[model samples]
Target: MTQHADVVVVGGGQAGLAAGYHLRRQGLDFMILDADTAPGGAWQHMWESLHLFSPAEHSSLPGRLMPAQPGETYPDAGHVVDYLTDYEKRYGLPVQHGTRVGAVRRDAGGLLVEADTGIWLAKAVISATGTWSRPFLPAVPGRSVFTGRQLHTVNYCSPADFAGQRVVVVGGGNSGAQIAADLALDGNAHVTWVTQRPPRFLPDDIDGRALFDVAAARRRALDAGRTDTGGLASLGDIVAVPPVRAARDAGLLTAKPMFSRLTASGVRWDDGSRAGADAIVWCTGFRPALSHLAPLNLRGPRGHIPTDGTRALGEARLHLLGYGDWTGPASATLIGVGRPARDAAREIAQLS
Candidate 1:
């Protein structure tokens, strides 16, 4: 049977749920298709020790605020998953789990979302597939021949997995720093941090909340045709959370320049020194999981589909949510995604 709806939200993560909240208020019949068997979306796949840098009040979806767990300043991955599970039940959001979408194509009836379970015929589609599944691993020479273990942040679970190993954590972003710290401090792994460039660490006072504010301010400035005047903190800057701070205090947060190439045992540095590593944890980041929209021929250079706000320039009926700031400012974060999701919902509602 082909399920029909006024709007189909792909990827029932925070962004999809946010979009769905508005759609429900506008009396629009919509369905959220989630790839994960559970409700937490990408958070479920995050490393076990992962915790939001911001407080629970700062990280939330559209209608409901993420309730802070007692005695915890920042919620852990499990807390987030629990919240997401409750959020779905609270709103009774129509989410069909385990229905991974294979492709979305145009049809005479409407946009057809072909899934592993069934097909969704919807007038409008909001792609909220956040970038958890598509972890980016940078290409380095001799990568294919590297005999040591290699893993990306997506598959990373815990420091215990790499216990008593020489682990090289790659990338300069928060994930890289956090994971490296975890391994060296807790996993008892001898860890080396690698970066393309020196990483910036924000003041202890600044967290994800402050970062979002800065990004939002930048967006407002750009929209008003003015220069974005912000000091210090940027997206790439690492937050000095407890673990990171402890690591820094212990002199374990130092980073080395990127290696020249991979070796069978480990990596070759630019200085012609080879360091043997038992595993390489690539915390580089993720690419948008937009494979379902490939049939639309909307992808531009760098695998990004250009958008005017959240609406895809190639197809207006198609709106992209939560991929990144390209679609909407801070659309990838819990608090940040609401703006684009609301806008997309309103746009879809107005269309009907």
Candidate 2:
């Protein structure tokens, strides 16, 4: 027989973990279903050499300090996994790992979730799968004819992995910028990054300290519909700078505007330019994965759920975390996910 609970959260990343914590604390029956073997979804999948821009103190979760070692810059990818693992052991949070959700449906009474492992019925479901599951790669012309290995930055593990090849990286976001910097410093390959528009880089002293406060503040505003950023502006694209320009000044790399087509042995630009390289890395952005949630009535076009005026997802009974520029402050931070989670749990409690 299928297990029943008061709530069932999909995805086991920070959002899901905090949601689970809130539900349990409120004495609500709930379980987390995760696709990975453990928590820390994308963090665990980061390129092996990555270190978070935010320091560990800023990366802390609901009730735990990520780590408080001075002189320790933000954590490497491994540190993220370690932290999440500790979070599991720390709280003994009940999570079912490696369980692929099949679908989520609503009946007269409540939500029913089906997964590869089994079926679960709950009063509500929290969709915490942030916008990274499906990496959006543009349909470049002649892409199939390219006679080189092509990979997304999402799959990149380290600079050493591309030690001896000419790499063409597409996209100007944080990921592409950092990857280009890494490959150039190692003297491993000729790195050419492509982004239509260059970003504004700030001074080192600026610190760009946004991890905690932004996450915390946005959570309350997003849920209450009183976010100060106003309408769609609240969810505008957010970019954080972390000393990326220093790499640009070094002669090892240069960024070009993106081209529209791919050739058998090189890339072609829209301005009628041509760049030949041994490999191509697409650094395109991400979108949320909620195709499995069609039955749940959770989303509209482009994967945005029909939340109540962008404040709450549908009602207070359900809450969306880490969506829309991570604008709902508390919902976005490692330390802040709890506030919204707690509020969501409280709202759920009022439901039954």
Candidate 3:
């Protein structure tokens, strides 16, 4: 039988949970639909070595703080997964786990959410589905002809898989840097880091919180009708986490400009030098996960549904949260997502 809710959240990660927290505060009935069989959201899929760049206190959702684990300066993926699980229980948030949302379309009543398990008719729909499900890989020439393994960050699991192999890790973001470091140190792999531009590194002391503050300051400047520099640090600017610092200290963090194209066996540099590689790990990042929203035909050529604040521009009852800066500045991060989530929830409540 088809069910219904006042609002339906399309993701059960930090963003969706944060939305739930605020929805509950407004005394609204909503259900979060998660694709994962268990808790943890996308964190459950990260490579085992991944850890939060920020400390525990700085990486929390609304209404609850993630407790610091002993001896863990920064919580790892497992800790985050556990925290997300606990956060759901602690707040008593109603989450329909394992129900993957297949589509969301507008009906006469409101929005109809079709999931793997059942259908939900909601007065409002919050699309908090983050980008992890859609990993972006650049279309380099000869990419299709390459014989070696090619994997995106979403599929990357551990360095052990690439041990004793020469692997080219593309992208300058934290995922590429962290995975390259892991392969170099833990798996004895010869790793080459490649980026479109030189990777910028924040000071060793700088963390996620500092970056968020910079983003906020830039946002405030923009709001005041002034020029915004977007701060000296961006979310993509690599943080000096312990492993990254260690990699730098060992001279393993050097970055090379992006290769001109992919060759049959490896990549060819702009200088015409070719390196034989057994595998290529692309950390090029992700596009927003809006396939479910495609039925609405609201996406532009860039695959973005334009928004005014948290509300989707064309579809007033539809809200987009936690995709990235386009949805809300710093919305991709844990602490940063709460602002947009709260705002979206309040807006959804008003509609209800």
Candidate 4:
């Protein structure tokens, strides 16, 4: 059925759930559009050995606490899925699962959202796909020649899947290090971490919660033009962490040339060292996945739709969350998504 809502939230992750609740509280009629079959977008596809850097209770949405089982070390991907599923049920958030928004257009009438299913209209649109939307694999020489079973980190689930195989993990990011460590511990595989950039490991928290990168608070300070005044380090600075030292010492990591393209045999590095790895896991990163948005006249560098306040675009209405520092934490987090959702809901309510 073709329907119109006061708001149409894209990417039904924690951000979308939080927005659904806030808008409902304001009595705005809206529907959340998600690519996932259900809620818990990325977590559902996360590495099987994955656990949150923080405790489960700490990562819960605003209204509810993520109930942890006895002796749980933070929440694993499974635990988070349970929590998010429960959140959906508790609030009765309207969701269109398996519906992917293809492109977004704006006009005087309102916002036009095109999805794989059909078209949707709303007073405002929120993009909670987060910065990590697309998996990025660096291009190098002879990429096609690599005759190894290679996969992006997005498809990774469990260490057991790569059991007894020689796996080479590329990239120096948190995901790469964590997965390599887990594969070694669980899969009984020969895991090698090859990255051009060195990585730093975060210290375990007071209660020994493994610290992953939480850059929300730091972004707020940077957005306010205060990065030099002790704000969070930019992307360039995250590499300088001391954890890189710790990871190297643990024999879980190695320094190698930038990934050249695949070769028929295995993989080659920029510096010319090669490994005949059985499997290659790319933990690189992502780009905007809006290949469907072919003609959305958005105003941002690259594919980014930058925003200032809840501004209007060409012909569309938009209250962009995770685009700027509208409220709460400004980083790409639930903390970041929550505040903007509140603002967007309020703006949409007024427009309606």
Candidate 5:
């Protein structure tokens, strides 16, 4: 049986919820299809010690502000999960859980969303599936032959599992910094943190709120046809969240230059230095989770579907939300998703 809606949203995460909130306000008939069996989206899968870079007040979706957690200035992953769970219910967003979309193709009526549960045809489709499930591990030479246990950010949960092991964490981003700090603070693993270059840390006082503001400023500049004002990239890479700061201040989170290759026992550097390891955690980051849109044949050489704002250039009826800045400035973050989501909803309403 074909399920028909005026619009179909492919995710129920922060981005999808933001889209649904605006869509509801616009009086558009839409349904959000979430692959996860429960709410919280990717937050539920984050490492046990992970915390948001901003306070709860600064990290929120549209219509509802995330309530501050008791005793936590920067809410943890579990708190985020609770917030998202409540956000959906409070707004009564129509979210169908456990519906994994396999592909999206053009249909006679509109776009066909083929999911495990059923099919949906809609005049407009919003693909908000963020990158959690598709962790990207760089193809370092001999990675396949390494004997040590290897895992990506998606597969990691707790630092306890790697206790007392020699662990090498690769990547310069937030995940790598956090995971390395988590393990080091646990005082169990001997951690070797490596990045392609020296890890850059944002000022200790800066957090997600500041980053979002910078992105917003850059977006405004671009819209006015002004010279490109640097966004988050102008600031450093890693945010100095409490734990990361503590670990770095204590000299436990020092990062080495990236190793050249993997060895049978561990990793080897270009300078002939080698370290043995019991496990390797690849915090290399993720690609946008857009495999379901493959049938559309719109992805370019960079694996991104070109877009004007959130609307796909190749498919006007489709909008790709919350992948990153290309979709909107900071659209991937909780607080940042609202504006782009609102714009997408407004555009979809006009099309309908």
Candidate 6:
């Protein structure tokens, strides 16, 4: 039997929930299909020590402000999970948990959303599946020959797992900085942090809120047909969160240039310097999880579904939300996703 809805939202993460909030306001009948068995989306899987660079109040969805975690300046992953769980219930969003969507294709009537649980025919489809599941591990030479344990940001849980081992942390982003700091602060691992370029840290005062403002300003400029202002890229790469700041000041978080290639036991640099390692943690980031939409054959040269605002150019009835700024400025962040979600919902409603 095919379920029917005006809109079928894939992925019950922050992006999906934000879209749900707006869809409800538009009085559109919709169903959210979540791959996870529980609420909290990807936040549930983040490392135990992971903390948001912004405080709870500043990191939130469209309708509700995230409650401040008692005695914590920046709330951890667990706190975010709790907030997302609560937010979903508070809005009474109709989410079908554990229903993993397999593919999205055009239907004679509308769009067909084939999932493990069932098939949904919806007038519009919102692909809000964020990138957590698609961790990207770059192909460095000799990577396959390395005998040491290798993991990506998604597999990381705690520094204790790698304690007393020589671990190499790769990538220049926030995850790389935080994980390296976590290992160093644990005081048990011999940690070497490496990046393609020298790690750039945002000013100590900068946080998610500041980054969002910069993104918004850039968006306004772009809308006004002004020159591109670089947006968040104008700011440095890493946010100097408390843990990272402490680790940097203590010289425990210094990043070396990325290694030239992996050795059987560890890695080697262009300078011929070699380091032995028990494990390598790749925080190289992720590609958009858009495999479900492959049947559409809509990807452009950059491997992105070309879009005007949130609406897909290849398929007008489809909206791509929360992949990144290409969909909307700062659309991937907690606070930043709201505007894009609202705009997407509004557009869907208008089209309906």
Give per-residue CA lDDT, model 3, range 1-352, as digits (tens): 8788999999999899999999999889899999888888899998988999889999999888999977998999999999999999999999888888889999999999999998999899999899999989887898998999999999999887887898999988788888888887775788988888998878888888888888888878887899867574544578889998998899988998999988888999878899888999999999999999988989975889999888999899899999887788888889999898888888887884
Model 1 stretches astray by more than 4 angstroms: 230-236
List where candidate 2 sits over 4 angstroms from the true fold: 69-71, 211-245, 251-253, 309-317, 330-332
Model 5 per-residue lDDT at 25: 93
lDDT for each residue of candidate 5 in 67-112, tens digit (9 for 90 to 100): 9999999999999999999999999999999999999999989999
Q: Mind giving the per-residue lDDT tens digits that candidate 1 earns over 124-190? A: 9999997888888888898899898999988789888987899999988889989988887884889
Candidate 4 vs. true structure, TM-score: 0.84
Candidate 2 per-residue lDDT over residues 1-352, each given as its tens digit: 7889888888888888887777888898889898888677778888765777677877777788888545557667788778888887788888999998978877666878899999988888787877667788888898899998898877887777777787898876678777777787777787888876754443343332543444445555766788464432233222333335457666544667778889988899878888888889888888767766777565666667766422345544455666544424535456656666776777778786
Q: What's the true lDDT of residue 125 in model 4?
A: 75
CA-lDDT, candidates in order: 0.89, 0.72, 0.89, 0.66, 0.94, 0.94
Q: How accurate is candidate 6 locally (lDDT)?
A: 0.94
- Clash pairs for candidate 1: none
Q: For model 2, state the Cα shift of residue 168 in Å.
A: 0.9
**Prediction-by-prediction clash tally:** 0, 10, 0, 23, 0, 0
Between prediction 3 and prediction 5, which has the larger TM-score? 5
